[model samples]
Target: MSRPDLFKGIVSVAGGIMLPIDQTLLPLKEKAILIYHGSNDDVIEISKSIQDYNKLKNIGTKNMELKIVKNANHFLSSQTFKDEYLYEWLEKNI
Candidate 1:
């Protein structure tokens, strides 16, 4: 997100925004953002994903989607499911 001009949309999987993001640029950035997190992720807690989502929303992300894969872990064990959703989301956003 450092260079919003380059990316049309952002897809974050098992990732979290640890540092504070400037709201000035974010509020004007209406690009689609997709966040996918595994519920049983041991590496990064799902709560972090949720918090990240909330942060994006609070900062004014218009077209954002958050998906939590059930029974999945940090590795995203269900590749099939992830691929399906990812394919769909990318097609729709990109």
Candidate 2:
């Protein structure tokens, strides 16, 4: 069977697969990166987020926060504390 050409141009790099966020060479200008991933996400693997967070820390990313919500799916429906967390983080950072 032939492979589907899904997200060809958008999710690719120089005719190859795009690297994950931590593996990419792009510079991040944000003062802080708040990544929230569900532990039970069915779409994206939780390992990817953990890897990214570790890589960010290894590369000395300032104010990098990773929150893993338990029992939440891809939409994080089980975790609804984003607003409060965001507000507090923003207040402290900005």
Candidate 3:
């Protein structure tokens, strides 16, 4: 979000922001976002992405999507949505 001009859309998988959701003060409500997280991720808790997604929605973000993958891990060893959905999202957003 620091360099919004360079990014037209965002796709984050098992990723998170350093700051708290309520503390985010940037104008990110309109940025097209695709957030994905594995339910069984051991590296980063899924709550980070969940909370951030909810916070973004509550703050009036419109073009945002969240996918809480089941039976998956930090590296997404059990998920398969990337083959098609990811490309679809990228095609539509980017």
Candidate 4:
């Protein structure tokens, strides 16, 4: 089956998906960037988030954090809509 093209518009947007990481996140280095991804996520691979974290870290972002929910799916099955990690991040950042 062919992949439904979801990236066409993404390419048009500067700092959108599949674009250069530095271009996308460099401007937000001063901001606290908290990324959340499920380790067992099938919709979006966890490596993508890790790669983003690594790139941001390499760029000297000190307030960045990546929380990988173990054995969780895309929506983090068995967890509340606002999970603990999210709550903690919000409390710290906000």
Candidate 5:
């Protein structure tokens, strides 16, 4: 999808696929923060995070099912989050 198709407005589109883990309200709240960024540096950090996610996902079974959302940034905040498309995709795949 085009970059424009990713966002609902100005925000990233990947936000919807998240499982609502909030890191800001952590430890006490037992939340997992979804880190979001808009720069190249952030992109690199996010890529590393995704790699880490893949690693974790690989531990349970010999065959791993991995889905990488297209055009999504580190926080999974693509423009696509504005609609239910990403959610539907995740529901179907994950």
Candidate 6:
């Protein structure tokens, strides 16, 4: 599928400080990347996306949060949504 089509169902079900990494700038180098900090609007957008996805999938929000990483695309690039940062955020929020 096309790149955009592949991420059509993407969503973010939690909120927190996002240290989104820049994958396009990876391998050949590394950098500390962050985006959408303290942005309630962005967080809400993410939450809506998640909610829409869940509804489409016939799922319920038994346990969900409202937040997201910008420029990370779906799959949340390794550089953009690194495990360490994600876990830390999840630990604090969830």
Least well predicted 10-residue stretch by lDDT in candidate 6:
25-34
TM-score of each: 0.84, 0.62, 0.82, 0.67, 0.30, 0.26
Error of 2 at 40 (Å): 0.3
C-alpha RMSD for every candidate: 2.4, 10.2, 2.5, 9.4, 11.9, 13.9
Question: What is candidate 2's lDDT per residue for 13-60, written digit by digit as tens?
Answer: 012113654434334323366777777877778877777667666667
Model 3 whole-model lDDT (C-alpha atoms): 0.80
Clashing pairs in 3: none
Q: Which portions of model 4 miss their true places by more than 4 Å?
A: 1-17, 77-80
| Residue 15's lDDT in candidate 4 | 18
Clashing pairs in 4: none
**RMSD to native, candidate 1:** 2.4
Q: Report the C-alpha lDDT of model 6 over 35-59, residue by residue, as the tens digit.
A: 2222234324455454443442343
In order, candidate lDDTs are 0.79, 0.55, 0.80, 0.58, 0.36, 0.35
Q: What would the per-residue lDDT of candidate 5 be over residues 6-73, giving only the tens digit for each residue?
A: 32222122222233323321221221222233233343544554554444344432222233455555
What lDDT is obtained when candidate 1 is compared to the true structure?
0.79
| Superposed Cα deviation of residue 16, candidate 3 (Å) | 1.1
Task: Show model 1 residue runs off by greater than 4 Å.
Answer: 23-28, 77-82
Minimum summed lDDT over a 10-residue window in model 5 is located at 24-33
Across 36-72, the per-residue lDDT of candidate 4 in tens digits comes to 6777777777877777777767878788767676777
Quantify how close model 3 is to the true structure by its C-alpha RMSD in Å.
Answer: 2.5
Q: Of the pair 3 and 5, which is ahead by lDDT?
A: 3
